[model samples]
Structure formats: C-alpha cells, structure tokens
Target: MKITIWPAGILAIIFFISTSCKQNAPHEDAAEPAFVAHPVAVPKQDVMTLEIGKAAPDFRLPDVNGKFVSLSDFDEAKVLVIIFHCNHCPTAQAYEDRMIDFTNEYKEKGVDLVAIMPNSAMGLLPEECGYTDLNDSFEEMKIRYEYKKYNFPYLYDGDNQSIAIAYGPVATPHAFVFDKERKLQYSGRIDGVEKPGGANAEDLRAAVDALLAGKPVETPVNKVFGCTTKWAWKSEYGKKVEEKWNAQPSTISRLDEDGIMALVKNPTEKLRLINIWATWCAPCVMEYPELVALQRWYGHRNFEFVSLSADNPEHQDRALAFLEKTHSPVQNFIYAGTDKYKLIEAVDPKWDGALPYTLLVEPGGKVVYSSQGPVDLLELKRAIVEHPLMGRYY
Candidate 1:
C-alpha cells in the first residue's frame, strides 16, 4: 500500500486534533445558552425641581398630631400653595408670621396653604443650626407648629425625604403655587425681600392671585435665597465636619483667678456658656461631651462655650488629653491655683464648689442659667436658644 503503517503517536495526535476541533465548533440550534444577561450598573439620575405646569407630586405626610395628610386633601381649594419650610432656617423663621397671615387671608377665599418641613435631620449638623432654637426634626416640627399655632397644615417629610426629592426645594422658605387643577404655576422665593417686614409674600401672593383669577402667572420662577436645603445625602458632610473639628489643636491654657474672672465677665458680645469641671470628677467627665455639643449647636451665632477645668495647673496635660479625647474645640483652661474655693468663686459666685457647675453668661457678666449637678441638657439648650441675643428668629 502507498500509505505505510503510520506511527501510533502521530495517529493519536491527528485523532485528538480532529476531535478537539469538532468539540470547539459552534452548534446551529443549541439555543445560544438562553441569552443570559448579567445585570449592569447604571448611575442614578438626579431629581430636578418641579417645573411650571407640571402636576403636583403626590405625598402623604404626617402633621403635628401624627395624622397623615395628603395633597388630595386640599382638592376643594381653587388655589394651593406649598412652602418648603423648616424649624432651623432664619429665613423660614422670618416668614412664619407672614405665612400664618397669608393662610388666614386665603383660607376664606378658597385657597389653602401647607408648610412642608422638607429637611432630613440626619443632614443637619449642630453647627448648621446657629440660626434657630430647633433642628428640622419631626418632633421639632411639632414643637414649632404648636408654638406658632399655625392655621395651615404643617407636614413633615424628613423621615425618608422621598417627597422632598420629588419637590426638589433648593432652600428653606421656597414656595410653590398650584392652580385649581393641581398644576404647578410658580416656584421660588416667597417674596423679593430676604428679611422680614417688606412687601409681605409679594411674589407668592401674585402667583396665587393670578392662579385664583384663572390667569397665567407673570413670574413663574424666581431665585431662592435662604438656608440650603438639607438633603439626606448631605449627611456625608457631617463626617467631614467631625474630622475637621477633631483635627483642631486641643490645647489648655493656665487661667489664674483673674483670668477666670475675666472669662466670666464676657468681654465679647457673645453668649458665653462656661463649664467648670475636674478631670477627677465622675459627673464632670460624663457631662463634658454634651457641653461640647452645645458649643457646636450655637457656636456660629453670637455664642461661645468656655471650658474651665478644675484640674490643677500641674495636671493640665491630663485635662488637655481628656478634651482631645472628647473632640472639644472650644476655649479650654485649667485652674492655675490650688485653691478650689477661689476657682469656684472666679467661675461663678453662685457655684457651691460643686464638681460640675455650669453657667450661661451673657456679655457683661449677666448670668442667664446656673446649674450645680449634671445639667438637664434640654433645659440648658432652651436657656441658650431662648435668650434675647440667641433667639430662634432674626
């Protein structure tokens, strides 16, 4: 035969190559593995503010009484107004009376107004609350609603913020007006003036008036000027604030009797909150952090929180370490003298040489609050926030 006996190894290699080629070849009717699709990641789209003529976004939110209220509840009104307001914004506080008056005036005319607190408390840092006595929490919303005796509905959208994301308010005091059909006709500042006592609700009034008259609004949009809307995503900034505050140098100075007296005198125009604490005192160590928190809550306003350590001058390093551990960035001092009575007298005459004494001193040494034991933080907060110089509103 022309084909001699082939070597077994060569024949085996040729057979393997032919079988591998057949196995690798595609099948014509194998169903192509059922066209499996792996899920792909898509970026989230940003929610934009409502545009003029758009249908009002539906929402069911809780009012002060824990009763659920919805947009459809006001269907009988010929005109509707929604104010994205909060407890903490000075601009929103400035317009509270005006909003109340507007609600009263328009309710008889078949127009209804509702104030929606569209802020997430998680996004509100204590430092961002300098302008008011309360933060934008549902509980605080209830407090404000009751305090103001608001005629209109005051709903809270802070839990999930889905309603806020839908409305997309850029700032507190932002206003939206809707016609009888529940179509948005205007969105923006409540009026031209930022401060109170001008042409009250001029812009909002015009939009409501136009809609009630069955006419198109002349200015459908205006630039909003107020506290930036506290979106839930903004909570990330709280970490940065904490980091920045912790990075500050935690130094303690030696304050003699005179220096301590000077601190009590409060030369500056700020409301001074002074705490006298000893590193060895259990109550002092426990309550120190809350005092620091108070500093953050009202620091941006005309306020200062001074920490005067009852620790001896020689133990300043120990006191400084404690302050650093607590991330206290306020002015800190350690008593330079060994006399505890002088320290008590210098900080506050009313102090009975207690381990943890606190004082809220106004400028020129007027004592607004004094506590001997672990303070009731809420009471202390109220004292600080309700003071004349630190009032909630402008």
Candidate 2:
C-alpha cells in the first residue's frame, strides 16, 4: 500500500508549506535529507566461483538517457564484455581511464563492451556515494555523461534490481567475458590491480587475448575483490561500528526520546528495532557488537534499528566516547527531565519497559517481538523468513 500520512502529520506538512510560502523561503533549496553513514566492512566476493562453460546471463538496462539496451542486442559480436560498475565506487572510479582504454581497444574486435551500473533498489543511498546528488534526477546522469565525455553507455537498472541478482555480481568492477558462442570463458578482476597499482595480472585482458587466439582461455576466473557490490551481499557489523563510535567523545551520544517517538509515529513497513541501553551496564556494552551484527546482518536497509541511551547527563560524554570508538548504528537518543519508566510509558503505555530491552516493531506500529536481552541473529532471521513485508530491517 502507498504511504498514508496520519491526519496530524498531514496538518503539520500543510502548516510547513504555508509557513514557507509566507517567508519567501530564500534558502529553501539548502535543506537536505539527513545522510547516514553506511556500515563498513572488508569487501569480498559472496560467490566464490563460476563454471567455465555456461550461457552468460542476459540483462536489459537503461543508459544515461533512459534508453533501453540488452545483452542479446550484440548477438553478432564475437566477444561480449560486461563490467559491473557504479559512478561512486572508488574502485570503479580508479579504473576509469583504463576502462575507456579497454573499451576502445576491443571495439574493433567485434567485442561488445557494455558497462552497467547495477545498483540495488534496496539499502543504499545513491547520493552517499556521489552517484546522485540532491539535484540529480535521471536527467542529471545524461548531462554528466556529455560533460564527462564518456565513450560507453552508463546504464541504470531501475526496475527492482532484477538484472543484478540474476548476474550474481560480487563486487563493483566485476568483469565477465563470453565467447561468440555465448559461453562464459572468463570472470574476475579487471587486471589483478587489486589496489591502485599492484601487478598487472590483467586477468580480463589475458582471457580476451586467449579467446581471440582461438585457444581456450588459460585462466577461467580469479577471486574478485574491492569495494563490495552493496546489492550483492548483506552487511553484518552495524552495532559493532556503532559501539566503537559511541566510545568517542566528539559524537553526540544521547538517546532523544522526542526523536524516537517521532519515528515510531512515522513507521514504515520495514522492521524496526528499539533498543534501550545504558553506559554503566556491562551486558549492554558486551551485546553492542551483536546488535550491530544484527543491523549489518539485516544489511542496514532491511531493518530500522535505533538505540536509546539511558546514561545520566554526567555520563553522556563517556557514552559518546564509546559510540565514537565502536561506530554504533542505533540512532542515538537521550531522555531528559524524565525517568526511564515515565519515558517508556509516554512512548507506549501498554507495558513495562526494561533496560537492555528490544522490541521488533513492524509497520503500522505493531509490535512483532519483545525481549529483555540481546537478540539472537538466527531467531531474528527465522522471523524475517516467516513474515513477509514490503521493506524489512533488522
């Protein structure tokens, strides 16, 4: 179902519009949606290997201009090269000049070089990676192409990410080369240039060269590594980073009761995790990594998890110090001029609220699960498997 705003929020939105119109709103364009830092991890391939002889997966995607292009379109070509890339990923950007050189070199060889941006419709924020900005609409991608003078089609997979999952790409810059017979001959790193300049293992070039020689490609594949394909693998360290960040003094470490209440009121179909924790509690601190794991395991987008710090004002600094150290994902908040009971009751008077407590609130503000301790990943994963929602979060 489409999002239906509550009557009170609708009135507020109307009031906001009216207030904006009255002031002339000179800086209206300056407002931006808050950008959350995604949980980080070592990039690795989720798929370890691909068989040498199999038909390449076909895909249809839109170029920068929103024109549809398909894999089968190059049926007459002897070699079809597909590059899984994105505008914002550093690894893809690092190889920009090299990609242009490779595409140019093989075009005359009846090689169909198609570079595709396989962004998942879930989890990621495009603007965070510099792919899109506040002002970047589909039109902006086209303008960027002309401005950058790109020689290849910069395609977008807008439709529910059907092509990405089908291709099973493990990371950005994933290259696959197919012979004219449409059999998968090579798959792996662009040039074994894992970092900026390692050795020019040149895996893709070697495979292409072997195929062109009318000989079997010596190496069928290698372990591809780099910034992971955000759409391909689920993240597993949401709370670990948050705990690390929370330990830092520079970060704001309070759990704002008012802010959490607002989010509860504006809930989405995504699964919501509500954690009540404190600074002095060792169990809470110890379980911090698991919570982050739950978030990352849920892969950030699948679950909406927020943290409420129960530390007193005097301990706020220490709490923040811990947050900075661990890099927590639980949306930080604090309760002021109120006891825990009062605050919890005010948020929801239906039952008693306890420390180290977690509630899985589904959309429409329905409580799915409530417990007094840290959540178990296997149990939560089972729940997600059982219940189907439009958007899910851990």
Candidate 3:
C-alpha cells in the first residue's frame, strides 16, 4: 500500500508528489518480489556413498518440462552426467554458464548432462539467498531455467531429496559421472575454479575424457567446494549464528511516552527512521539483515535509524541481544508501559499496531515515508537516496 504521511508531516502530500516524480520509474517495479522461505525439520540425510564401481542410481524425477525423467532417459548416450545443483548457491550460479556450455559441447560426444536441485524449499534460508538471483524453491528453479534458457534437463529432487542423499553431494555443482554401462566413474566438482572467469573446468573435463576413452578416471573423487546442501539442520546453524551475534554486549533501554514522542518528533537535524519490530516476527527477522545493511550504507549521510521493540519488558534482554546479533548500530528501545496501546498510538496511529513498521521522518519531524511488513528493498533504496533531506548527501 502507498502510505500517506500525516498532514502534520512536513510537506506531506507535496513531498510524496515531488518525490514520486524522481523516484517512480518503470523498471523499478520490474523487480521480482523477494521470496521468504520457511524452515522445516526432517531426519537429516545420513552419510551415504555410491561405490566407484557400483551402478549409478536410477530413479524417475520430474523435469522443468513437467515430464518425468530418469537415468535411462538419455538414450544412446555413451555417458550420463548427473549434477546436483540448485538456483541459490553462488558456487552453482558461478558455474551455470559454464555448465551449460560444457553440456552443449559434450552432448555431441554422447554425454548427457542433467541438473537436479537438491535442497528442500522449506530448508532454504533468506540469509543464504542474498548471494543469488533465485532461491532453491521449485518455482524459483522454473523461473531461473526460463531466464537462463538452460539447454539441459533440470529436475527437482527437493521433495524427498532421496536422489541427493543417495549420491551424497556435499555441495551444489557437485558432479557425478557414469560410464556407458552406468558405473559411477567420477564424483566431485565441476571444475577447479570457484570464481569462474579465468578458470577452466579442468577436473571434470579430465574425468569425462578418460571415461569416454574407455580408461579409468585418473581422479575418481575430487574434493568439492561450495555452499553446503541446505539440509534441515541448517536452520539450527542459523540459530547458532544468531546466538553468536547476540553474545556481544548490547544495550536496550526503556521507551516511555515522552521518550517515544521525543524520538518521533525528530529533534535532531538528521533524518530519523523509526522502526518497530518484534523478536517473534518472522518477516521482521528476515528483513533485519537488510535493515542493518542500509544503516551501514547511509549512516554517514546524516540519517539516524532507530529500532523499537514491542517485546514484553521481561524479554528486553532478548530483544537487545537480537539487535546485537543483527549488528544494529543505532538507538534501540523497548516498550516501557504495561499498556501497549499507549505506545502504539504514540508511535503512529496509522501503524494499526503492525509488527514491522517503519517511518522516515525529515529533519523537522515531518514523515516522508512509512511502510509496514517486509519492504521491497529496491524502493527502500530509492526512497533514501531521493528524499529531499538525503538527496544532497547522495
């Protein structure tokens, strides 16, 4: 929803109108909505191995085309190449173009390259999503496939992830090659290069060449390097990272009506951004990292970003620790009164008591921007840079 700043806000309507002129561009709205993935628990995939001389696992899985594909799908192919991959990993993205090129080049030599997304969508974390344009969700995989126009078969194994566990891929872009008779010939990385530009697919190329020549692969198993498969246990890892972050010293002070009103009034000369969030708000937590990043980006530009937690007084320390974990480098507050309504109305009547509410106030206490829930980061960036108060600094 487009927010209308209160009349008391400086140049309220005019500010929106004028800023809209410079801020609203056709392409800005073209950005895809950010996908927030939830976490779920399941028995973690135990260590498993496909012995070097053992037959490659044969199973049927749905391809991007909605058709079921299996190991036997590649007919008359002298070699089958199964690559455990996903859309989110930087390592996987870095190798996408290279993977496509390799498949095209090798297809002429009877080599079939089939890609599979190995992580459950529920297991994907937003913190792990910043590095890529897409997540590991099935919908995201389809979007990515259409966007990249990948020539090889891209399948989904995230439902049960049985194939992934069977092959035991440590990371995305982990390659598993099978000879004409479907024997596991090579298992490891697609290349020696991680960053991609100047590096060649040396390791994988050698393995494939040797097998095609009817010889043993010189390196049967090369170590793989990439983002760990987003197993269910990764959710616990996120909690641990948050715990480590919160372990640092942090301060969370009580915020009374007078103090809250004072903060909202923007007594200081800097543009003040007041954000109301809660420890239990999933959307808020998902957005915390980006909020911290914004502060780092615009802190020197005379912008002050303050956070107010609606968490109960008894849990103030928890809120403070969360702020610290998020690397919050600004004023932090906790609702002080027993009456939550007083604090809510005092903060912003238009807020309707939302968990994650943000308002950017001009130096004179006039709000220029207000939003609730998770914000489209693109517009958030534009709002900060194009505001009259911040334009000069930009």
Candidate 4:
C-alpha cells in the first residue's frame, strides 16, 4: 500500500507508536524514540519588507575602494548572500571569521557573498561603540575591511541607507540569501551561536546547499539576534546621549608627585588608563577628545581613565579650561610640583619623560600597554577590550 504521511498525521502516529512500544516492550528502560516531532517557531518578519520568494532589491552602493557594487553584479552566481553588517557591533565582529570562511568555501561552488555596512554614524552613540575600536563610518569601513581582510565585497550603505531600508535588516550581521532567479530563499542570522568560535554558518550553508542543488530551503527564515541596526532616524536619540555627556561637570584637581604615584599604583579593582599630557603639547590637545570618548565608551565596565597633565603648576587654570572645552568628565589632574622629573619618575620609572605618555595599568599596578607618543586610539581601544578583565562580549 502506498502511504502518504501528512505532517500532523505522522506526528500523531509517531507519538502513539512510541507510547505503545514503551509500555509493552520487554526492555522497559529502552531508549526513547530516535526522532521526536517538535513544533518549529518561525521568526516574525516585517510585513512591508522583502518576503520569501521576493526578488532581491537592486542597490548600487560604494565599496571600500569607492567602486559602486550592485545586485546585478552577482547575476552569474547560483546563490547570493548579502549580509547587513557594521563595524562597531560586537556580534558582527564575532562572526567576521565565519563570514570569511563561508565566502572562501562557497566561491568555488558558484556562490557569492557580499557584505553591506548599513549603519549611520550619526545614529550610533559613543557608548554603543564600547565593544569595538572602529565606528560605522564609511572611512572606518575601509579600515575594518582592510584590517579584517574580508574575502567578500564590502559595500557602504550608510550615506542614505536606502538600500538597508529596502532589505529591512533588523540587526547587524543579518543575512539574506537569494537563488539564481534573485528570489530570497533565506533571511536570518549566519548561525544560531552569538559568541565567537561557536557553530559555523550552518543555517546559511544549508540554504545555499539546497539552492545549489535546485531544491527549496528547508528552513527559509530564522530569528536573528545581534546589535540593533542604527537607523538614521535614531540620530535624535544619539543627540540626547551627547547632551548628557556635555552637561557633566568637567573638573581638574592638583596632583603632587605622591598623588601621581598613588594613581599609578592603581589600588582599585578597575583597569586604570593613565594619560600624562600637557596643555602645551599639541598632539596631546589634538587627541584629548578621543581619550574622553574612550572613557565614555568603557566607563560602564571595570575601567577608569585618569588624565594627568604635565603642564606647569602655574598653568592649572589653562589646563582646566582645556579639559572643560573638551568635555572631559573623567578624573583630571595637573602636576603640582615644580620638578617635572619627579612627576615622570612617579608615573613610571622606565619613562623617557615624554609628553603625551599613556599606559594601561591593572588593579595590582601591572602596566599592560604603554605608548610614549601620540596614542593610536584604535590600538588603545583594542588593548582595553581584549584584556583579561574586559572582553568583546559577555
């Protein structure tokens, strides 16, 4: 007899058979049924956005090299995967390796993977960028693209975000897969795992494999969880964060040689970032704002940024004024001693007594990172986040 098993009917029969077999079987402790039917919860998709089987939207966005890349460019590929990702999101950063591996593995099979940065810098707050060294600006996109050595075309849609709007990506690292006819076959995350070094891009790979074999995707859509996409309209909210930061009172205190030594000792449990700069130092003044931004970024964690000015004790007013102008809300101090050598020795014995000296000290006063010249903010941020105490993700 030819039997046609409907989904519900099959589930009921499996349940009945398993129950009956368990009750009558000689081995009462026999293992449960090899296969059990569990209802799959489908993730909700935006009603107005691209639906399953809908044609992929056309987009002409600039790549890292300033060349415009469009959907039609991948027409020859049997499968196309477009990932809406950004530079700042930790989740996106974690999946970078997987995306690269997926691209390299599938390229030989007529598959193309393209990444589009779809965040507006205006909508991203400094605190939101706490987990990353780079923000979602187009220029930063180029930096990330080159630094990460992405195997796929990395495009920028941050200017207007019109392309992002059409795709309706709810989060960074959201993936959309299209077949040869440009019909969307899958739309969700690259995998079920959120943290780095977990599952490979199994969900995405499954969709691609099915489409390549001229078969429908078994699971076309799944829930995507990551940093929310920074839409341009959210700039108003970003302004509020800036206003609150600026409203905080900027104050500077006098730090003698003893005080500087104590600060360097770092008795507290937090990671202390000590920056020794002077108001007269041009590079110090130029990079002060970024230092303030770094404080704001990692301030919530077990981290503190302390600024020690090497300006003359008599120039306290000038130093304080500069701090106020830069909206520095961190612990600010100016050396109160006439001898600059004492200040230098107190901060670090191995110091060359260079202006704009920066160092990261652990709780027990172990210096993890030290820079003598103008600090590279990106390098500093990486050192901070990658430390044992702080991580890219929880």
lDDT of 3 at 150: 97
Model 3 steric clash pairs: none
- Give candidate 1's total backbone clashes: 0
Which model scores highest in TM-score?
A: 4
**Model 1 lDDT per residue over 1-394, tens place:** 5879999999999999999999999987775232221222222337689998899999998887778799889999999899999998888998999999998888999999999988776678888887766777777777788888999999888776778789889899899999988999999998988667776899989999888888899999999988887776766678899888778877788989999899999999999998989889999999989888877888888889898888888888999889889888779989899999888778877777877889898899999899998998867887888788887666
- Per-candidate TM equals 0.81, 0.46, 0.56, 0.86
In the order shown, what is each candidate's alpha-carbon RMSD?
13.6, 20.5, 19.5, 23.5
Superposition TM-score, candidate 3 onto the true structure: 0.56
Error of 4 at 94 (Å): 1.0
Tell me how candidate 1 scores on lDDT: 0.85
**Cα displacement (Å) at residue 88, model 3:** 1.8
* Candidate 3 lDDT tens digits, 176-233: 9898889898989888878767577878889999988988999899888887887765
CA lDDT, candidate 4, residue 350: 89
**lDDT of each candidate versus the true structure:** 0.85, 0.63, 0.78, 0.86
Q: Could you give candidate 2's per-residue lDDT for residues 1-394 as a string of tens digits?
A: 8997679988999999999897885775775443222222333444433467888777776677656788878898888888777654556656656777777888898877777776542334332332211112234456546655777887765334456656767777788889999898998888866454554437888898888889998888877775565542233343444455456443454435666576566366587777777777777888776665455445434466676677776677777777666676456765653567667764566646656776777787777777676666446544643355512111
List candidate 4 segments past 4 Å from native: 1-47
lDDT score at residue 33, model 4, on the 0-100 scale: 43
User: Cα deviation in Å at residue 276, candidate 2?
Assistant: 37
